[model samples]
Target chain A: MARPLTLYYAPFSRASRGLWMLEELDEPYALRLIDIRKGEQKRPEFLAINPAGKVPALRDGDRTVAESAAICAYLADRFPDAKLAPAADAPERAAYLTWLFYAASNIEPAVMARANKWDVSAYQASWGGYESVIDNIAGAVRRGPYLLGPQFTAADVILGSMVRFGVSAKLIPNRPEFTAYIAHLEARPALQRAIKIEAEYVAQLKT
Target chain B: MARPLTLYYAPFSRASRGLWMLEELDEPYALRLIDIRKGEQKRPEFLAINPAGKVPALRDGDRTVAESAAICAYLADRFPDAKLAPAADAPERAAYLTWLFYAASNIEPAVMARANKWDVSAYQASWGGYESVIDNIAGAVRRGPYLLGPQFTAADVILGSMVRFGVSAKLIPNRPEFTAYIAHLEARPALQRAIKIEAEYVAQLKT
Candidate 1:
């Protein structure tokens, strides 16, 4: 029997990354949407599930997973038929891990810094200067239509979500490469479906 | 033949986490120590391997994995026989993924903020303030002998490293739980072995 998966998510939060992955995998999951505006994420019940009280927490049977990148990696590995990640022993697995962590550690922090307008000393910051991170990302994207080249893996899902968010927030300058990459990712049927569903959810909340 | 694994590292850097994991794996690996103070990580040759110029980048054959947590996860998955990670299909895998990402995303950032004495609105920060991050960590350890109950996994390597670093920097309070946890982790033969080798490297460089 397939274990049931429950995702505690909020619309337009980082949880969307995991939602997109679930769509890509075509897995049956129950989306228990928590409204961050209502302070639902800070409720004691929610805190028990994730002491961090962040959105996009996943529960599979008795196990709960938080952190968008970790959730995505876990799903990809658990559903090997999706092939969203390389096999553990496959040589490509190293690159797979590299990009996955890079998306979270490098790209995410860089975006946050830009969004918050935080002044960070590049020498002490692990992601280097914001410009360096941006240049590195552009160089990587210039290498292909996807982060790992032709084959789209789970890294693309997380990276795509981040890029899309950045572009929407004007955090990433509207460069030709950024525009093309976002378009390429949005063209994915799974992402389109996820976005559509999220849009409907948002619309429902508005009414 | 097993694929070659090489770690680009320097003693006392965050890369020590990767070195500790390599020792735990008991796998044959070449350690190419890069002295950060000498700007070796910024050299063109090393830059080609990791433009991020971070220590603890792992090269497995033609593929390179960076970010200490990512490298730890990759190695655990790559050498499944080491049982450093929960089985991909196991529900506990979610817990493993959660804490692993937590170490990087939450703990690392919090430590940096504390170390740099950066003051920002905790509500505005995604990490939910250093106090919360520390509390969450202490809560997790108090539930321990390990992050994942009695079973030690790569999450421990990641968390253990952060805990040790945090305590040393006085970022985390030296409470009994924190002290005990660090002692438990440092006492591990693998960590001891890595530390011993790193101390030797540091001492050699001094002369």
Candidate 2:
């Protein structure tokens, strides 16, 4: 048995992506829910775990990995048995790293900026707003069922969940490429399990 | 000889950091300067290299990798002889990945948000703003000369450049920890070469 891990998660937050990744890894882990609705994530104790006070923070033994994409990348490498990453020196590894950071540094911010209708100038913004962010992803995924093609990696989880949320929340235009890419993710049994588990967790919150 | 690589860089852009990384790797790479002031990044030919129209894009052989942190991480692993990354299965590996993603996903965006004074609600913004981002990095670096301690990695390059830019721009506070961190980074030989090269590139624009 591996060292036990804990994922401090919230159903409605980006933690959903972390939980989805956990399910995809097929590893034994514990989930401790942080109720974002009640402002539980901002509590003192939770802030100690993540000063940013975000959910989807994972603790492996004494080490803590926060930020959703970081957690996903760490888990992929830690559980290399899952083979979600290419070898360190593999040629494919460069694109894998590029897409993961792209999602974190660009896609997430662009979606939020668009979702909130923030006043952002395209040239001034690093992400250049939602249209091009979407365009970049679509241009790549148009070649694939996966961002890396042929093999599903953690990059897929990052891109798939972000696009899924954007489409579902009506923040992103329902383009054919995004629509099909999200549908492909939806069919994954791991994502289905994550959805089911969160439903149970959220239902328990009401009682 | 290793495969020849090209760095599509611009002096005023974040591409300076990418050039820094190439210098750190101590490998020979040709610098193809893209003049952002002339709107070169938005030009048709440049768009073919990075459809997002971002600088700091890299072309290794025929594969293209954009995003500075991603490029740093890729080059670090690609040239493992540089000893910039922890061994794949090392205990330090998770923290290594965590900091790299933190720089891209958290520190970089946090600086931009603070600099632009975006109206970001703390909980809604994944990066939690500049103060918290600085706090997180300070907490880690106060324990070190580098993010992972006693040794420098590509992650330091990312954090170092961002803080240097942030403090110089007066966007990030020049606190004890940050000032000390920037000073430590300035003492690095690789960074010195990057700065010298950038100055030369900039001087050419005036002629």
**Who wins the lDDT comparison?**
2
* Fnat for every candidate: 0.78, 0.75
lDDT per residue for candidate 2 within A1-207, as digits (tens), equals: 545799999887889989999999978899998888888878999988886677889998888888888899889888888988887767788788889989888987888787777777777767886888988899878877888888889999987888898888887778899988887888889999999999999899888
- Residues B1-207 of candidate 2 have per-residue lDDT tens digits of 645789999896778889989988878799998888888988989989888788988888877888898888888888889988887767777788878888888876677777667788778777876787888888878877888888899888888888898789887787888877888889989899989999998899889
After superposition, candidate 1 runs with Cα above 4 Å error: A1-3, B1-3, B117-119
Q: What is the TM-score of each candidate against the true structure?
A: 0.95, 0.95
Residue A161 of model 2 has an lDDT of: 87
> Each candidate's lDDT (Cα)?
0.84, 0.85
Return the clash pairs for model 1, or none.
Answer: none
Which segments of candidate 2 are over 4 A away from where they belong?
Answer: A1-3, B1-3
lDDT of 1 by residue, A63-123 (tens): 8889898889888888899989888887778877887888777776666776666677766
**What is every candidate's C-alpha DockQ against the true complex, given to 2 decimals?**
0.71, 0.70
RMSD of each candidate?
2.0, 1.9
